[model samples]
Target: MEAVVSLDARGQILLPKEVREKAGLRPGDKLAVITHVHGEEVAYIMLIPARKLAESLRQFLGPLLRELLGPEESEGQGGAGPG
Candidate 1:
């Protein structure tokens, strides 16, 4: 989807109604804004629902943590290893 929205005087831009509805956003829902910077300038911006971001992080990190900690340690035998 492509959209061009103008930033209001308050430094806020309103998402198009179609965009909001398609993203399943509700009035009070939270969004996580992600940005990519290139050579001191922001090149791109993205948004993901906060809950979705947390779920994605958990899915990705849980297995990696389990592997790093080893099976026995992953079962709650200890805390994080040396950095």
Candidate 2:
């Protein structure tokens, strides 16, 4: 979706409601702004939610942690013996 927004006096721009909804963004959601040169004369920007990104990382890291820590660490930490 494409949206046109104007910057306020403090140089803040609000994302349009439709655009926000389509992107699954909500109030107080954190975003990462990235800028790049689209062409020789044009620049492009994107916003991504930090929480969503972190969630993705956690999903990917789960198996790696299990492999590194073993089954004992997976159950719990510092126990006298297995029940």
lDDT of each: 0.83, 0.74
The deviation in Å at residue 52 for candidate 2 is: 1.4
The TM-score values for the models, in the order shown, are: 0.78, 0.57
User: TM-score of the candidate numbered 2?
Assistant: 0.57
CA displacement after TM-score superposition, residue 47 of candidate 1 (Å): 1.2
Q: On a 0 to 1 TM-score scale, where does candidate 1 land against the true structure?
A: 0.78
> Which pairs clash (backbone N, Cα, C closer than 3 Å) in model 1?
none
Weakest 10 consecutive residues of candidate 2 by summed lDDT: 74-83
- Model 1, 1-83: lDDT tens digits are 46899989999989999999888999989999999999999998998999999888877876787789886686584433445
Quick one: how many clashes does candidate 2 have? Answer: 0
lDDT accuracy of residue 17 in candidate 1: 92
